[model samples]
Target: MELFNQIFVDPFVTMYELPDLLLQTLWEGFVSGTLYSLIALGFVLIFKASSVFNFAQGIMVVFAALTLVGLHELGVPAYLALLLTLGVMYLLAFSVERLVLRHMVNQPDIILFMTTIGLTFILIGAGELVFGGEPKAMITEELGLPTGSSDWDVFGGIVIFQHIDIAAAVIAFLLILGLAIFFNKTRIGRALRAVADDHQAALSVGISLNQIWVIVWFAAGIVALATGIMWAAKSDVSFALQVVALKALPVLVLGGFTSIPGAIVGGLIIGFSEKLFDLYWGVPILGGGTESWFAFIVALLFLLYRPEGLFGEKHIERI
Candidate 1:
């Protein structure tokens, strides 16, 4: 007990003597939570529009990253590469709207989900063919983003922060803000809501279902690109990063497919709780590696209590 206390338990209990580490951990959790919310937003958008869960959003993240880097490798300027990447996403949106989705509009949700899974494979193979399977550096400083770290002395300990992390948090918050407005305060947004409510009824009206799909998919692509950039800044840009995107699943489960604010709040809750529990409990009491499934276990246990989710509409049987 004494050896365990000295090795694992005491390090965190002595956090008071290490206020900076505590502050740093909190900041990192917040940043991770924000990024998770962004990924969740992509899922929510397509789900609301078409009533199909877009399982391919993770690959979209990798696709966007590959697009950006592949363009740069071909002698395009960094800024131009970003612009061209957005154009590629836009073209993809249009093509899918005109091609695959137009044919599959009335398909079952399960079928649509499987289609997305297939699309994931397509994107993975295409990205690999275009960019090769290598981890590439993000053009952060080239994009004039902040770099290095800033430190503050708090209680005789330095609370250090990555400038890139701060930038990512700010950019993600702004992106969410923009999406909130687009969804809540626009004519097209109302049309989208109508489609979500009843696709056949929406078609009966003047709303162009195909156009709406393109817009929503392209919007999701933009978010994916942003996610790719921020994530690449932290790790390497690789197809393997799609695995990280899976973390957003528990976020959606805790949030609810239809609720945007729920995604954000749920992500923050999961993020902070995991960090706290893994640090204060898992490492000390258990033999670590708790992060692998900590969020899933919390989500599953919470789901037993509130199956419909905190923000999801209550499900009641109609007699």
Candidate 2:
């Protein structure tokens, strides 16, 4: 009975007694989910365009952030460093298309996937050599992001909201909006969609495969930079940020590999579920440390029921 009470009854009781804490936990989850969605968005862009599972996306995030910080450390202004980082990402995209994907064209999917894994190693080695293996603080003020917090008193308790968290949420929403417009309304976006639908057919219609690959990769790089800055602000910019890539796999699974909106929704689901479970049950009963595997377990269960994910269309592949 004690175990049952602790498992089911006590957490609810605590939530009821301290509603503000519950709200605070939810807000934190939302912030985390937003970041997860941003990372997953990078994956979707590459996969949708090229049908390649780019395993290097995580390292790309760390590399982009490190580049920005490294440039700033060299006495470059924050905004100038940001522009330089974008230029670097564009060059990377172009070089990748010219030197890597160009030769790998018409290769098997497995081959493309392996190529990305190799790219991941090269990026890691290069990043470590250039930036060193030390963690650096995110220059939040230099980038003009908000700092400090706001507290709300309600239901006989105080709920604290960090300004940076609020800014992150708003920026994430705007990014999504802009991406939707870009993909749906622009000529380049139409070309991208065509390439995604059928590469050969797109090529037949005069759509340049090399150009599309460069554009898609460059777009993914920009998303990585945004994700890096936000994530580094929340924590420290470090090679350890690469591990968050593992965490993002669960989000991708939950959201489906091809659906953008699904990524956002799936992230929120994982984020909220993990946070609430850790606070209410895991810490109290399981001796803590549940957040690490919580999202994966949920994703596994979700996939068992709806393999296509919540928003992804069902793909019926006839053998």
RMSD of each: 2.4, 1.2
CA-lDDT, candidates in order? 0.86, 0.91
Model 1 stretches astray by more than 4 angstroms = 1-12
The candidate maximizing TM-score is 2
Candidate 1 vs. truth: CA RMSD?
A: 2.4
TM per candidate comes to: 0.94, 0.97
lDDT of 1 by residue, 187-305 (tens): 98898889888898999998999988999999999999999999999988998889878888888888888778878887887888788677767776677788889989978977998
Error of 2 at 167 (Å): 1.1
Alpha-carbon shift of residue 26 in model 1 (angstroms): 0.7
Residue-wise C-alpha lDDT for candidate 2, range 1-319, written one tens digit per residue: 9899999899999999999999999999999988888888888888888989899999999999999999999999999999999999999999999999999999999999999999999999999999999999998899999999999999999999999999998888788778867877999889988998899999999999999899889988998998899999989999999888777788888888888888889888988989999999999999899999999999899789988787766889899
